[model samples]
Target chain A: MYDLRELTEAVRTFNRDRDWEQFHDAKSLLLALVGEVGEVAELLQWQPAATVREDVKAGRLHTRLAEELADVLLYLVMLADETGVDLGPAAAVKLAATAQRYPASKFRGQAPERQ
Target chain B: MYDLRELTEAVRTFNRDRDWEQFHDAKSLLLALVGEVGEVAELLQWQPAATVREDVKAGRLHTRLAEELADVLLYLVMLADETGVDLGPAAAVKLAATAQRYPASKFRGQAPERQ
Candidate 1:
């Protein structure tokens, strides 16, 4: 139920309940994003990789991730929203551009950095 | 000159040199993305906050970030590229979507997680 669509609805509810439409200004949203990321780091503080990855799958790390992700998406949505970008379609657009650059022949099999 | 466009050109050049298309299957691209992320983490391995921030502004942390970002973009571009989507336009699309959800009223003044 917590998939992307469900989560989006929650965002709408949160928005309606709190009447927070005025404050999610771009700058603020980005700052909030930094804060959520900090929280994510807090979860990993002093923990080993094993613990952190486990936290992700276990849904323990960002107990707030759903909300935080919403926040991030909020920013994304807003940026897309304000700029008239279509959220879902934009991803498709960017990919088309990449096809020209990577050309399939150059990007395959390369390690992360080298490619 | 090392802004997004320049970096993109580098990707093209690298592609031409390696002829790696067959290998960079989606799976490999993602694996490479993860590895690039690891490289960023390694730079911060045991480093203090002061050091990490400095790297970001001073361009040290992901000396590979540009490349890594490109790799991420490569994936993004391909996804967009393949789906008949345009990269630049897609961002605009996503932004328009955010505008409705955040609406600026519900998201302000909230600390990172609270919002």
Candidate 2:
């Protein structure tokens, strides 16, 4: 039940408090988003896919992957907040397009080749 | 103004319509999220950081990166939806912990050394 609007407000407040908004334009935030994401990918690179699930169930998810995931989400939230993009709606719009492009029945369990 | 709750609802409905919910659990979504994130990272790998910003200003941001970002976010949003984690509020909570761990004045403009 958490709202992205609330989190975006929090990010705004957090940046305003530190005068860091100057450092957070759409471009910079995008770069940082990718950087955090790369960190997440790096952690998963060393673990087998099955092991990732096992680690989650074993309460060991936080050893690295979870934190990196958190970082990626944080930057993403911040970027969306800065750009005035309501991610939920933006995502909804994108999904609508995706659904049209890849009808569920056609692409079920299959990866679409990028054109 | 988009609610993560609303986006989560749409994802739930979308999957339910296609019976794709069986494919989306915490573990699988996590893997997919990282995969999308990796795709985002790959696009940025060849471009210098400055070029990324330049690309944005030139109105050419989405030849690859923006879609990849959207993909990463869609998976992330879906993962949070499945896990019952409210991303915005969850982000606020994590930022609080990060703020405590790395005070703004101490870590401003400096990446923290991973411990």
Candidate 3:
């Protein structure tokens, strides 16, 4: 229901309303990302992959997963946005660079970290 | 080695080189996202989560994972960019929405899908 610009506006208003922007500088924001990720990881901590899969299916996992994931994405997008980065075309270039770095024959059926 | 704007420019050039912009409309771009995601999944197909962890550590997985993940992210960023979306402010907005939807009291020690 929320398109990107409107959504971004709301976030700005929220920050200004609470005067949270000063603290949301790059370092703090990045730290927040780590913190949120920790929270997300906590959901799967001490749990087997099977349980994690089940939890996802049952909608019984931590509430922060989406929140944290979104947080991470939001930060990344925001950082890029603030820096005048255009995501769409930037990605296309990354893909090209990645293609050169990791070819399909080497990549096929490979895990993310492997390549 | 790449900042966001330069990366985006490279991507745009890559597309223009192939005259691919016309096909990069919202619909096609979205479909491309699906395809990239599928490639990422293929790395884990029939494999245990343990294997995924190992692959990530040892760098034994498909090359496409980063490529695809970046692709999905790229499309999202581009879509937002073209539409005049600012990542940082927009994300702040989403965080606010999410914070309201799921409070810390409800979020602690939970996996992503639940709550």
Off by over 4 Å in 3: A1-93, A96-115, B1-6, B62-64, B82-84, B112-115
lDDT of 2 by residue, B1-115 (tens): 2676667677777776666776775666767776776665565466555455555434544435556556677888776665445565566667887778877777666645645
lDDT of 1 by residue, A1-115 (tens): 2122333454555554556655654334434534543543453456553343344434443334333333334443442332233434333344445557555565565543454
Model 1 TM-score, 2 decimals: 0.41
Residue-level error in angstroms, candidate 1, position B79: 15
* TM-scores for candidates 1 onward, in order: 0.41, 0.71, 0.46
What does candidate 3's lDDT look like per residue over A1-115, in tens digits?
1344444455555455555455544334434544544554464455553344445334544333444445656654443333234444445566777657656555554433523
Candidate 1: where is the Cα deviation over 4 Å?
A1-13, A44-55, A62-71, A111-115, B1-115
DockQ of 1: 0.06
Q: What does the TM-score come to for chain B in model 2?
A: 0.84
Q: Return whichever of 1 and 3 wins on DockQ.
A: 3
Identify the candidate with maximal DockQ. 2
Per TM-score, the best of the predicted structures is 2
Give per-residue CA lDDT, model 2, range A44-111, as digits (tens). 46656545545543454443554665667778877656544456556766788888887888877665
Candidate number of the best lDDT: 2
Which residue pairs in candidate 2 have backbone atoms (N, alpha carbon, C) closer than 3 angstroms, thus clashing? none
C-alpha DockQ for predicted model 3:
0.08
Residue B94, model 1: lDDT of: 39
